[model samples]
Target: MGYLRLLRQRPILVLWSSAALSVLGDRLYGLAIMWVVYEATGSAVWMGIAAVVESLPYILIGTFGRGLIARFSSFGALGWLDAGRAVVACAVPLLWSPGQGGITVLLVLVLLLGTLGVLFDPNLGGLVPDLVRPDRVREVTALLDLTNRIAVIAGPGCVGLILMVVSEVQLFAIDGVTFIVSAAAMWWLRAHTHRVARAAAPGAVTAPARRAEPVAAWPVLRRHPDVAVAVGLHGIGFFVAAVSAVGLPTLLAVRLGQGAAGYGLALSAVGAGALAGNLLIGNLRAGRWLTVYCSAWTVTGLALIGYSTAPTLPVVLGVGFAAGLAAPAAAVTLRTKLAGFVPAQRLRLITVDQTVIRTAGTVGMLTLPVAVDAAPATTFAGAGLLLIAAAATAAATGRRVTAAAIMSSREPAGSQTS
Candidate 1:
């Protein structure tokens, strides 16, 4: 289904709008908070600490709090969480001061918001499947991905525009307002969904069976080896891609003698590429999703290597665009497959996948910056090679798993000794 038609459905429209606004708010808050921290402390070290703190919640929640996500996988709970985040975000400007004590409070608030985010994300993922037809899940996923890309491109620009007229501290208040609007929309959606469920004929729709015992994502992953391979490759890709967070700016400064304008252009290229890629994949009807997923990463790896070799700004932009183009295919493919799982298992696995990716990214961010600065081209090439190798491993493993399944199916009923 086309995005417009699908979005015309009130539930999908509300959900998409809420998500878009939330993401934009997140982007604005991230930039604003970082600016505030640096301005108040004038320390790069403190900024780095704040970055690490922001990522810690994802690892912590995804590891130990998966059950929390499962338990609160409802619109009402999600709405409240957004509302809570709003309060936390707005507190930053009001509570902060100019000394160490103020920075400590700011860090705590950042952690609180991040924790709420870690819970909010997987629950929202689980909720999406219930709102769309089975076959149209991929389309909805693409649409959501598109929202993220637009936010990536536009959010910082929006912040820049806002800063021209208002103080950086006020951005937090604006972000809080966005969250409040999102919460209101979600509450309305919850009421609408409940009404539709009640109005449906008794036997018209069957609900997913609830499991008495919560299933761990690892066991389910073992049962689906192909998904396991895709997820593993995804983690590696994330780890390698983290280089860009530091590497891109370094590259533009060292090699091209360009600063903020060059960096912004490169980022814009990436966002535009991702937007196009999502649209392309969403419209296609394809099989062998595992192959497509691996291929996307392979292309991404190639783009990274290309970035290393590029000696000009234009080349960097082109390579960044290519890398962005391939990203959504990998993400959307994995999400579409996960959506096919039983609802209970699906939520856990999504959480696990997110944890793995976040953990890998955090590690990469900590470890790769020095190498990127020392030898930017060599480091990019090395990371690209590792990414390609990871993609190859996933593809080969998927093929073996597929062959084994086919051979087992071909065996006679009596020949199968359980």
Candidate 2:
């Protein structure tokens, strides 16, 4: 009650609640959709294709999506985008089969879902700090991380239980309703309007109004060496996760003959471990970005290689726990970097750039089936090698660059106070 009273100074609770609701539904539908596709066709290749379709849109609209967030109201853009996701999620069941029409429809829907997701994150990334106390950013981020892990843990298990009775279509429809409910909540959230400044002074110059504010994000990033390095390292780190996240699930369920329930159960271990790590070790004042970030990613890569050879449920579950714990810690550090760089108004644009980086790793995931086919032993080994290289490069470059600037850096300046 006391914390709620403090947070009540802004509508951070209401907005974050809406986020939790929508993301929970989104994750549930995602697990259901992936398993349903694998079930219908029994094809690992299509699973990879579906994963590609989902991430490819962010690659395509990476810049344009950022521009939209920067140009419009974050609340308005994200609310409508979440509503739009509800519409597309409903159509997922219609493409459950693996025939020509089924694959095409499913791929199309994946594209739509991914595009909407690209729009969703940037707007929301810019929105969150607006609602919370600035000093509480690490706290809010940790809570949000915890919330998302809870969703991942709970959601797949829910789908596993539901799959015993209802069809995937029913699950998809239920997810749609959840999104609609979430969007309604978001629409009602009392966020500080971006246009308030323009309204107050009528002379405020927005990002778009400034002719010098360019669209090329690479240059924007270059001005801040540490931030650019961090973002780039995030892109590389995602490759390791892609293989583990996308490849392992398919390998377990579709290739190994463990049903979707088995796959979800193993993944839930990941969510559970991540929830524990973030809650326990990822305190704002305790984390050592250089040491923790480097060692964690190295260990995560090794775990992925070990997972490729996991023969039993116990091994996979153990690997999942390690990977999940390390991955989120790394992600938290990158997000902290994001908070320090760009202005609050343009953070949306930067998030779009982040989406692009993740998509690059998805491209690696898309190639997994081909690699698996070529040399089963070699593929996993290659992923491990790449992971080490990426972590090494980032530690050598980004960590060193930022260490000197740590004391001086702060979250972006904005119209509103923390």
Candidate 3:
């Protein structure tokens, strides 16, 4: 009853529901675009170029967009972003034909979407602390992660069914509708909620203004070495994830002698496992977070090694599941630690921190191709060993601020003591 009661609260419910729908739409849109591109162009090179264009905004805008986000009302910014994306998604199908420079048009649209997404992302991260009670941040973060995992697991199957009955253009129409719904939900949440003072008196003292000189992110991170280390550990986890994502199909096709079905199953297993992991992490108290964080990576590293050597589809699936289970602990713990370590005043910097983490995944993915020429087993094993080292590094750094200490500093006002 209590959990359901919490879920019924308008802001939380609307934000979470909208996020889930948005993620599902993104998955569907991505699949449709890739399929359409390949079908129309009949060239893998074009697909690669599309992928690079899609990724450029994160790399470019993520570095420069934080200041712009910090200047606006995060909730309003997020709503406008959703609205803008909805417009773009709707316009995409109207502007394209198979042979008339469709690839160029797709690339431009993808770039625009990525730019909007980059601008939206940090503001969204900045909004979380304001939206929920201090103690609920970790749980909310984990829940968000769970929604994404669910989308990843179910999106392909949903796409398969949709494609059986509708054109890709029609499926994109559905995607546009999802964004419109998400934008509506965001607007509703904004209308119903205040960033601060849900229950304060009309004449309560307002907080002091931020400094004229913006707080430098690098200095703040330098002062909190633990935060930096935790971020790096998070990045390492992401790196492993990126590598596996790129490498799994190769392993299935070349080593295990399976095809698309096998790859899909393996991916499904990973997503399911990640969902389970996030559920477990969400319910866990702070006292156990560090232990879980360290152990999860250790297990994930071992799972990667296991996956590398798996001789059959079942074994590979099992290994993928195990790795998935371990993945969320590192992510959730690190994020929780961040919420504990970073002061409310500096919380906007979280976007920058997260940008680095995402970049780490890109770095891992880029490096993976270099090793693709090596045996699959050898490449995976090496990646596993690097993650194991990352686990050890996280544990070593974690001793500086125990989870108990983090729990004690959960207050929203001055949580930066970590």
Candidate 4:
């Protein structure tokens, strides 16, 4: 069958579509939340507090949510989480009122949203390997990343036009509707999978049994030391990328003396570059992944440094585009490798991988002010150098892992699991 035919027949397309919808709704809902909170509290401090409330849970989940993720299969975890988020999104607009108490309610809803997100994001990624054939994993991942980037680009671009047509409440109500679509898609995928599994095992009294003694997240990390090191380096890369995402606009607006237009241009350049990079990466073979990841990170760091030292807006924009281009190589390679390394049987690692990188990114974002206070250029240089080092470490350890695998068998790393 053609790739397009395979895509249409798989639940992965449903998963991909739902993720895009969720992202769009999330972007719009975030804008609505900020506006409502600011209008109610009239204090930037309260807004800051709201932001913290929203972010803290993800960090907590990254550290602790792995065991919880292991309790249910990835699909079960994902479908239920989507359903819960849909409920909260719908309730936000329905239950909201304009008062101090309304601000309190918003805070609660944001916390719930974050909590659901903590479980949903990782588990959803974890589910991909199980749902699709091993050969298609990389392709599915690339497609999913492509969908997410499209949503990220469209979400922010459309927010202004969307807000012009509807009140904050009305916008959130629409956001709720998207969540409902996402939830429904997930449930449908679940039912379809169950049916397929049943058909595959005709006359069997029951479906395949769940793992009787599921291992914990830390042990899985311990077992795969190379993956652990790679994951750590990946987390650092994430941190640098997250910090840059916030820092670039400030550099453009405050330090470079360019206004909103420059910041917007730089941001769009990053997204566009990332989209292009994903397309480029899809063509590369699996054996070349380690090289691609290392080179991408190393160059991305250099690009970030270039952006920091650039004298003109155009130069900054170009450098930002370069950084974006390199960013996804690490993401695609590491994610595809990790999915293969830790199969559906050892599901704990999915949550562990997602949570670690997410928490690290959040920390990087939160540390921005400190970096800025010390020196903006110095911060960029530090982050860039860290990424270069991470790439080197990943390459070194990845070799050891590959060598070990080769000694053990003729099978390639991709064939060892899943």
Question: What TM-score does prediction 3 earn?
Answer: 0.86
Candidate 1 weakest lDDT stretch, 10 residues: 205-214
Candidate 4 residue spans exceeding 4 A from truth: 1-5, 42-45, 74-77, 206-213, 286-288, 342-346, 397-418
By lDDT rank, best first, the candidates go 1, 4, 3, 2
- Top candidate, metric TM-score: 1
Write down the TM-score of every candidate.
Answer: 0.94, 0.77, 0.86, 0.87
**Tens digit of lDDT per residue, candidate 2, span 1-418?**
2234434654566666766777777777777767777876798777777877887767776655555545534465566877898888887765456577776787788788888777667656655554555666656666666667777777755667877988766677778877787677566662344454457668766443221122566655555555566566667677555566556656676446677777777888888888877865445464556556666778777876876778788888898888778766776665654655445424744565567576768766766657665555456667877887777787787666665455335545554555
lDDT of 1 by residue, 1-418 (tens): 4898888998888888988888888888878888889999898778878888988999998999867777667788788998998999888889988788989999999899889989888878877888889989999988888888888788877878888998988888889999998889878977887778767855466454342235688777766888888888988998888787789888788878989999999999999899888888888876799989999999999998998888899998899889888988888989999999878788888888999999988888888888998998888889999999999989998889867866766888888475
For model 2, the stretches where C-alpha displacement exceeds 4 angstroms are 1-10, 35-43, 91-99, 191-215, 246-268, 281-284, 287-291, 305-319, 342-349, 373-378, 399-418
Give each model's whole-structure lDDT.
0.85, 0.66, 0.73, 0.74
Please report the candidate that would top lDDT against the real structure. Answer: 1
Kindly indicate the candidate among 1 and 3 with the higher lDDT.
1
Model 4 per-residue lDDT tens digits across residues 239-289: 887557667766666568988888888878888888888877755574666
Q: Candidate 3 residues 74-114, lDDT tens each?
A: 46556788888888888788987787497778779888888
Model 2 has a clash total of 0
- Candidate RMSDs in Å, in order, are 2.7, 7.0, 5.2, 4.8
TM-score of 2: 0.77
Regarding TM-score, does 1 or 4 come out ahead?
A: 1
